[model samples]
Target: MSSVPQPPRWDVHRLPRARGRNFLVTGGNAGIGYFVAEQLAGTGATVVLGSRDRAKAEAAIGSIGSRVPGARVKHMPLDLADLDSLKASVDALGLDRLDAVVLNAGVALDRPPRRATGDGHELMFGTNHLGHFALTNHLAPLLTATPGSRIVTTGSFAAKSERLDLDDLQSTHDYRPKRAYARSKLAQMLFALELDRRLRAAGSTTLSVLVHPGGALDSLTPSRPPLHVRTTGERLSRLPLGLLVQGKDAAAWPAVQAVLDPSVHGGRMLSPRAFGLRGAPRIEPLWSHLADTTTAARLWTASRDLTGHDPTFTAPARSGGTEGPAAGPGEADASTG
Candidate 1:
């Protein structure tokens, strides 16, 4: 009798070569985003760091170059808080094709009297959820144009427990900073799932996948000189914490895997395996709250209204896919909240 064959296990250190691909990572200048960019750069693909600060982006690029010789990486200015500039920012990429874009940039306020974006929406909600929503709308054409392209939205474990109050999606009624931040992330996660549904309905090849970094701590992260440097003492002290959590570099695995893994499919979510807290990336069931299509549809309508962009996406005609027109915000399913 033939022996049973086992599936190959994913190895984070060994990524498939992507010599001709193009990838964009928003907020790739620091933290988990920086590590994601660096790891992607190792695959011999061109990586663009979408950042607001030129200086910081340059530092990140330099650090990646230092770590990975001949790394092809550059910067594109993106201010997610400024809704007006996102389209122009996308236009600036000037790429003929984009293989994947990691929507990882975000704003998290630890303590606040509460703040609003330039467009007057709550800061966290506007930048984290709405900003990516609008950016995806603008990039829809390019994404659909590229064969087998992906839009990877990096959500947060912090969102697991929160519920969306559709009446006040921006946290106008109740504004604790941490809770508001979690809500914003929850909105992003919901949007990813809904987008996947719409894309599948339209027969598009472009995929939208979701991921969350488990608990990541700066103290556990390795040093990337000129960008981030973890002192020896800090590493020694945080070593024990690594048993429960992980460093920012390790936290980046789920998003990276989503971008590169062939088996990953749209609408599926990847998270850490160790109690959703720390371990290698693995496919996980969507949380019950995330499965609420009603909430997602309503949030989609609100996002369209707030951003003035309808994200009804479709594949290019050449791809043997039909195009769909943008739906009116009020035209959301009657069954939706």
Candidate 2:
């Protein structure tokens, strides 16, 4: 009998060349998102860091340049808390064909006195889930136009124990900082899976992949200077924890793999290999809660209504212009956030 062949093991240190390809990472100015942008930049891809802070974005760009000589990276202003601004932000990307987008930006509030977004939705849920939802819909044209494009949604390990109350997605009735943040991430994960299902149904080429950083600690992470710095003592102190939890850099592997790995299919989830914590990234089975299609579909509907943007997977007809499609209204100023 023939043995089943295993897929090639992914090496986080070595990545495939993606010259001329364009990719975006939301919140790439810091944390796991920053590492994701840096890794992609090493692949010779044009990496855009979606951030709301120009100063932080520039600093991150400089940090990547310092580490990876000749790195191609820039920042696009993005405010996930402002739903009305998402469409304009997508337009500012100025790329004719977008290869992939990493939905990784989020706001995790730990203190009391629950806050809301500009649109009046809970801060975590609105910015983390709904904002990405609207942004994806707005970028649908570019994604579908580019063959084999992907949307990689970064979820969280905290989401494992939390369940979403679809009726109160905004956490209006019951509000807890950690619980709200976890549910928001759960919603984002569910959206990624449901999106793949919808894409398949529509016969679209764009793929939606989900991923989560297991346990990322700044103390365990290597420094990138201006963006992030770890002292020798800090590293030594966190060395023991490295056995279980990893740094943000390692946490970025799964998302990067989802973007560049040809074998990675839509609707799949990737995570750390060692008990879903501090090892290299590997494919993981979707949690039982994430497999509930009924919940996902309902959440999708609610998202569409709240964002007022329906994602259509259809690709637009290719135009003759070499620079890609012309910018839509309010897209003329790429520098404006």
Candidate 3:
């Protein structure tokens, strides 16, 4: 084929402004992070950029403001690798209520031994999975108050690397950089679906969804992959897969669509259009097993325990897999990676 194709579309651009909406987007300093925040702020929403580096966040915010002059954009400190930082972040941004929260911050590590966070959990699992787990739990109260609130998170097509491992969430038993990364992402996907399920069961119709950029990044989490696999991922894009490598700019499309599209429902998984690689925005489903209510509940329970916070506070009991309200001041925050 001369060029790769994109995903199915359904006239999504007509969506109106996000006026009066307040959002918290992690890693909104640059890359897809900035794109997501920029799109939202451009549409007239108040966006709080959550990042580890205050300096970096400030720069990113400045750029966003410049792009969307007078855009309601602000910055807050959020270090997914450190639990203490997570708490400080909550205290800083835990407002009266929040309209949306997107978990987009992550690291791509080089082929290296597994690391741990300040809380002593595996770094990837700690930062990528646990960090958001606590943040979401803490902010549930705000979500419940807002009728159409959303929590959007980014996953990876590589999420299939391994199945959910309740037994080895920390990867203390076996650790391959790719496998561990996949596990963490899988954990994130499960959390997204499970939170959605819990909300529906509780008679709450708020939105919680998952998204991935496909094989969208030349660089991924800070932890590097094996040279061969990583190099292979980088190689195909420049050659045979050039058309499919829609670039990181397109990455924010799927996430932005998820955030903006009113038709999107809870439990949906979105990706870009470029074949097995990349494209525009389209709605897709996660692995069938990801929707399993049993696993969803277990994952939620385990996450609350791992993060040392109650995911659902007065959020009401959940049915399917989602439990807890969407917004509550977070407690017992933990790291992501």
Query: In candidate 1, what residue range of length 10 has the lowest lDDT sum?
Result: 328-337
Residue lDDT tens for model 2, 144-243: 8887789999999999998889889998888999999999999999999999999999888789999999999999999998888899999998899999
lDDT scores in order: 0.88, 0.88, 0.72
Model 2 CA deviation exceeding 4 Å by range: 1-7, 315-337
| Candidate 3 global TM-score | 0.81
Residue 216 error, candidate 3, Å: 2.3
Reference-based TM-score of each model: 0.92, 0.92, 0.81
lDDT of 1 by residue, 1-337 (tens): 9989754566777777676678999999999999999998887778999999999999999999987878999999999999899999999999877889999999999997889999999999999999999999888888877767889999999999999999998888879999999999999999999999999999988899999999999999889987888999999988998999999998999998898777789999999999888999999999999999999999999999999998766756673664321221112122100
lDDT of 3 by residue, 26-135 (tens): 98887777767877776667899998887877777776666677788888888888776676677787577677889988776657787888899888888998988988
Report clash pairs, candidate 2.
Answer: none
What's the CA error at residue 90 for candidate 2, in Å?
1.4
